[model samples]
Target: MTAPALIRGYEVVIGLETHAQLSTASKIFSGASTRFGAEPNTQACPVDLALPGTLPVINRGAVERAIRFGLAVGAKVAPLSIFARKNYFYPDLPKGYQISQYEIPVVQGGMVHFFVGDQAKTVHLTRAHLEEDAGKSMHEGLETPGCSGIDLNRAGTPLLEIVTEPDMRSAAEAVAYAKTLHGLVVWLGICDGNMQEGSFRCDANVSVRKPGAPYGTRREIKNLNSFRFLQMAIEAEVHWQIEQLEDGGKIQQATVLFDPNANGGRGATRMMRTKEDAHDYRYFPDPDLPPLVISPAWVDSVRAAMPELPGAMAERFVTADGLPEYDATMVTQSLAFARYYEAARDASQAPKLVANWLMGEVSKRLNAEDRDIADAPVAPATLAALIGRVQDGTVSNNAAKQVFDALWTGEGRDVDAIIEAKGLKQMNDTGALEKIVDEVIAANAKSVEEYKSGKDKAFNALVGQVMKASKGKANPAQAGELLKARLA
Candidate 1:
């Protein structure tokens, strides 16, 4: 049995908490700029700095964006949601407490279809709430043997914390869900969806348990940005939990971090806190901010403005466009790619054919070059035209391949001119094909005689020689027709 098959006895249980930086121009609570990367104290306001009398003023944009997120997930928008003080003392948090939601959040009760590899698992949401981010701490070992710098540029940024139920099964499933969630947020015009700049971050809760056992003691892994590390970390944690169980060591419910380069090829997790040692965080409603209330009419307007979601678009691709789920998912992974695809299809007027060429040949090249769909030179319509040439036998398959390469960078220039210039137009002239076929047959008399004598391989060999002689531009239908007639 395979290694994957061998891990049958264990099942990985996981949940994810994703923190997305909202696109609002102002901070979540203060009027300071939400733009990233400015001078440390430039974006800082009195409230952000936790000054003597700087009361926090709620940014209406942050609250509205949070409501939009709630609507996007089909969640309930709480008419009265209050920001709370999450007390944690750190250099990054200037205030003794970080302003976040404790019990009552802005939104709750939503579900997102989580896909892993190919399996679709629906993960229910516990809540999605708006909160203000704390500042950053940049450590420099040289300055004071472990000194660090603080940048308040990110402090007080508007962040929507989306928390999900522990409904994930494997690492692949978690990563897939993360990606889907990221794409959805970007599509809604709520967040920029940039992970490297700390705009989007995920905290994963993972555990492993047998089919009949109670829930395993879970570990929370923090600050995972990209999907690759998410998968690696989750899988590593699952295996670690299994090993602990097998060794008769109890699994600890605590926060942990993925070193990423820990144990060996696979990484390891370190304990941040035990379940019993977890902090209460002293959650209470904020005094400076009032409960956010959104009107139903406003919610409806946002709902009307919302674009088609990722899951729905993928379904339409399969049902309406007759694409596979995989193909649909790939094309609709990003809104830009999907938009490009739809535009190209409209321009070309080929649905199924264009989808195939795009998701197949064009997408493959784009991925290999690490380029986005916008970077590709072959417009969707132009690809449809090239495929049409192949369908009409105007150019052989090999010749069409060459034309596709030219089209990829040439951006829909004349297909006929490129084909002629490249000498790739199919040679379907009966007289020309017959001469080449005859020449091949004469040169390979033994093979032709064997073909006539009932050897299938010999017939294929003769055909191959004819194809070679024609430089792979022979119209296969015409070549087969004349070759058989003259041979007989």
Candidate 2:
């Protein structure tokens, strides 16, 4: 009766197949718009719908984009790749087959190095290819007394299918790799990285193998949108499959889908014959679209145009700002966040002081309101001014907190005006605060006796009396120092 291992004595192996919808105005094969959430089938065209005599023309922008991704990851962009039809029967698929690159993809072989906690793990890339996305189906109306609705807006959108080798060992590693990939795509401007809109989607290939044995059959979980869901689904699926095998059942090699609404991965799935052979989708060199030949000059130009990615930004933040790794990680989670900190720090008189306030006070406010850094109410210059007032002893920390509240709620106009109008100036006057301190010591005779008898009770009482006497304007640090001096 020991703790049952999720991977058991089996080695956990994971591969990810990600479909990132390219950021373009038009669809891959048609001139139909690629915008999300238009009227159902509004974005569809004759080619998107697979009508007879409709020929698929590859989008040149998408092809160039796929090669750009290959160059970014230090991969080889294949000069010759064949487009094939992936035959599948689903209401979502307008055509009987999906036009995708099979044997020869546009990009082949890359590696993604991502952090799992503090350690780095690399998910070796098997291939990345260009394809078109299918339409979306709404099951909500089907369960009710209504017809199932189909949205063809997503159909024919350019999709880059990035397939990774089985390198991940845990769910955390899987999520890390996904996040890194998402960031890279967004940084490259190749994809919008909008997971909620299904622009960036993931299908995880997870298998649990016994030590020194052939790989076990894996269930492919499809279309995981959120990072939290990605971890939850993988954890549940890996353990569920392991338990099934431990109970003397065979691991089914088919596709599965994740449902957060389900009770502990109690989701339903249909049986599919997993294919080991290259699917005979009748692949042929695209006649409509010529071969996509990329030159070294183009690759270098694109690389030069690439922005500073999250990994590089984080490293610089730690080195240049002298911040902790965790602090840097929190700040660089979004590009907006990194920019916000830099702006605030540059505006502040004390840079590290600004960082501390940002990491503590600003972050707390953002978390409570669930707001992003881009949407912050307080401007960088204004926030820096407020922090400066506290550091310069013009305002107490307590008063600064009040100012911060007013600032957060968009009250009191501006930082200087509000501080002046509210009379929140700190009292560091020794003559005034010392009298209050003496009065407190005389009033709290028993507490003072407790301190004289080697207790700390009297010290806080004196500090409280000083704060109250100054109308809560006394600088707490200066008050403590003066009170201790008087006592000595």
Question: What TM-score, computed on C-alpha atoms, does each candidate reach?
Answer: 0.84, 0.78
Off by over 4 Å in 1: 1-8, 114-119, 141-145, 262-267, 272-279, 311-329, 396-423, 430-471, 474-488
Q: Indicate the worst ten consecutive residues by lDDT in candidate 1.
A: 1-10
**lDDT of candidate model 2 versus the reference:** 0.79
Lowest summed lDDT over 10 consecutive residues: which window, candidate 2?
A: 268-277
The per-residue C-alpha lDDT of model 1 at residue 425 equals 80
Candidate 2 structure, TM-score to reference = 0.78
TM-score, cand. 1: 0.84
Q: Report the lDDT tens digits of candidate 2 across residue range 54-139.
A: 98777878977897788768788886777767777789898776778877888999887666655656678999998889888886
Candidate 1 pairs with clashing backbones: none
Residue lDDT tens for model 1, 1-488: 11222244986788999999999998977888887778667999888999998898888888778888888788999888878898878888999788998788989889886445555567799999888888888876445766678877788999999999987777877888898889888878899988988889999999887876787788899889877789898888888888888989988678888888877767777887664332568788788777777788878877787788877888987898787787788778789888877876676666666777777788789867867777788766677778788778789877887888887766348788898888888886778888898898789989988888999898778778888888888887777777788888
